[model samples]
Target: MKDFIFESTPKIVFGAGSIAYLVRELNILKKKSAFFICDPVIEKTIFFNDLSGKLKKEGFIVNIFSEIVPDPDFDSCDMARDAIVAAGSDIVIGIGGGSAMDIAKVAAITAKNRKKAKDLVKNPELCEPGMPLVLIPTTAGTGSEVTHIGIFSDNDEKLKTGIVSPYLYADVAILDPEITVSMPETVTAHSGTDAIIHALEALTSKLATPFTDLLAEEALGILYRNILPAFEDGNNIEARSNMLYGSMLAGKAFANSSVAAIHAFAYPIGAEFHIPHGLANSIMLIPVLKFNLNSDIEKYCRAARAIGVQTTGLSEAEILNRLLFKLEFLLDRLKIKRSLGYYGVTESDIPRLALSVMKVTRLLSNNPGEVLLEDAERLYREAM
Candidate 1:
């Protein structure tokens, strides 16, 4: 094993009622004005109003930027940043799911640096210092609250790109499972599968360290046990909590170890079709796993066990086959769409998508397997 270094610096407040800490924590920060970015749907909830009122009572003026859309684009990010600056918000609160949080993160950073959001999109290397950013997650998936990465779609080019920097890490992350109770079953299923992909990718990353491996294993196990129950019973507090922790652990693991082909391929799907990141990940994960199975047979066997597949007395290849079969079975049980063809992908677009994926060598390089473009193109075709 080569020497590896790991550091995750987000202050995490995690529990069933941890949402209540928002006011108290903000109070301590002495930030008189704050901006909140969330989806319009979330803004309509009573929970948002209650929190807004509580902040007002605490002598804080909260401006809500509820213009966030899924697979957020640069123009919306610029609009959110303009709102943040016009409101003169001293602090930023990212509320809701990954898209909202990611938009807020870029907005806050853009405001603090006095740069247009488009600047970061045009010149990703130009990000400067960022303001105080807080993350409050309303879902059990994405884990953007604790991650140092934020992805946005470039609509013109049909590419999903990200800003990855230490400055993008949230100062505080509050995860309260209560907020996830209202998630639609489809959202829960999609997000849960995304979390599983995070853990799966971390386990197979070239940079996987002992620390990350342990976290990935435990997170995968928790997700395997809890995601289905949470999907079946949306209000099950225990299941929600487990899924929340599992997602958080997945974020922590992958933040250090990085994601592999699942993410590399998912980006194009997300960019082109506006599919939810998790659902896209779910669609591509098994195919990519099958393609990379030969990377490390023993590693695949261990991953099978992590996901609750029995592998006792089986050869590594057999265990790998079992794991692939189990994932296919789980996807079927969840009724997830199996192909990009079902998502409206045409055969003519395969070459372009393949070429775009080849450009995402950033993620591909992290795979334990050396994923050739031929292998990547084949995986995409198989997925279609």
Candidate 2:
């Protein structure tokens, strides 16, 4: 193992009905006025109404920026930043999935440092200390609450990029599984699968340390076991709890080790076709795994065993085959689309997509195997 550094969110409060911890966190930060960033869909939820109302009753001024758009773009962050500044909020709170949390992170810092979101989007090094920010995840995926990385979709370039800085870490993260019980079946499937990918990619990353491997192993086991149950019945509290915990663990793992070619393949399709992040990851996973089979045979075998694959009396290749079949089974049972053609991606698009992927050197450098232009085109073709 190489010498490594592991960093995570400063504070985490997790459990059933733990959303109430928000007030306590605000008290600790000595903040009374709060600004919320979320999608319009989440703003209309009864849960949000109740929480915001209750906070207002507690004498905390609660303002909302509910204009967040999907795939979390620079425009969304800039809009939310303007809202935060107009409200003059003492604290910024993000409530929703990855989109809302990511937008809130950008809004918080931009409001504090009095910088435009576009400027920081181009140059994340310009990011300075922001006001106290709190993240509350209403879904089981993304794990944006614990991570300092925030992704954004560039509509013009039709590419996905991220801002990485420790200053983006939340001061507090509140994870209450009760809030996640309302996820639609599709959201549950997509988000949970994204968590599994996070773990697997982190496990195979060249940057993986003993610390990250421990987290990724535990996260994969829990996520793989509980995802189906949670998908079948959203009200399953135990399953929901496990998925949420597993997602956060995966987030922590990937945050330190970084994800590899799987995520590198996910970005272009997601940015161009407007496909959901998790679903794009879902289709490309098997192809990239096949591409990386020779990188380290034993590690892949260990990962299979961690996910309860029956590897006894099986050769390495056979164990790998079983692992692929298991993932296919999960994707089938979850009703996730496996073909890129399903998203309207054509043969003509493969070259550009492969080119875009090669530009993501930050993630490619962490891949278990080298991905040349020909290899990327082959993987994209396979996925298509």
lDDT leader: 2
What TM-score would each prediction reach against the true structure? Answer: 0.96, 0.98
Determine which window of 10 residues in candidate 2 has minimal summed lDDT: 116-125
**lDDT tens string, model 2, 1-384?**
589999999999999999998988899999999999877888999989999999999999999989877887787888888888889889999989998998888888888888876687678787778879999998898989999888998777788888787888999999999999999999999999999999999998999999999999999999999999999999999999999999999999999999999999999999999889999999999999999978978778878987999888999999988888888899999999889999999999999999999988989999999999999999999998
lDDT of each: 0.86, 0.91
- List runs of model 1 lying over 4 Å from the truth: 121-126
Worst 10 residues of 1 by lDDT: 116-125
Q: Give the TM-score of candidate 2.
A: 0.98
Give me the displacement of residue 365 in model 1, in angstroms: 1.0
- Model 1, span 1-384: residue lDDT tens: 768888674589999899899887787777788899988999999988898998898788889989887888878888988898899989999999999998888888888887876687566567776878889888887878888788888777788887777777888888999999999999998999999889989888988888999989998899988988999999999999999999999999998899888999999988998778999999898888887889877667788999888877887877888888877877777779978999998888888888888878779889877777777778888988
RMSD in angstroms between candidate 2 and the native structure over all alpha carbons: 1.1
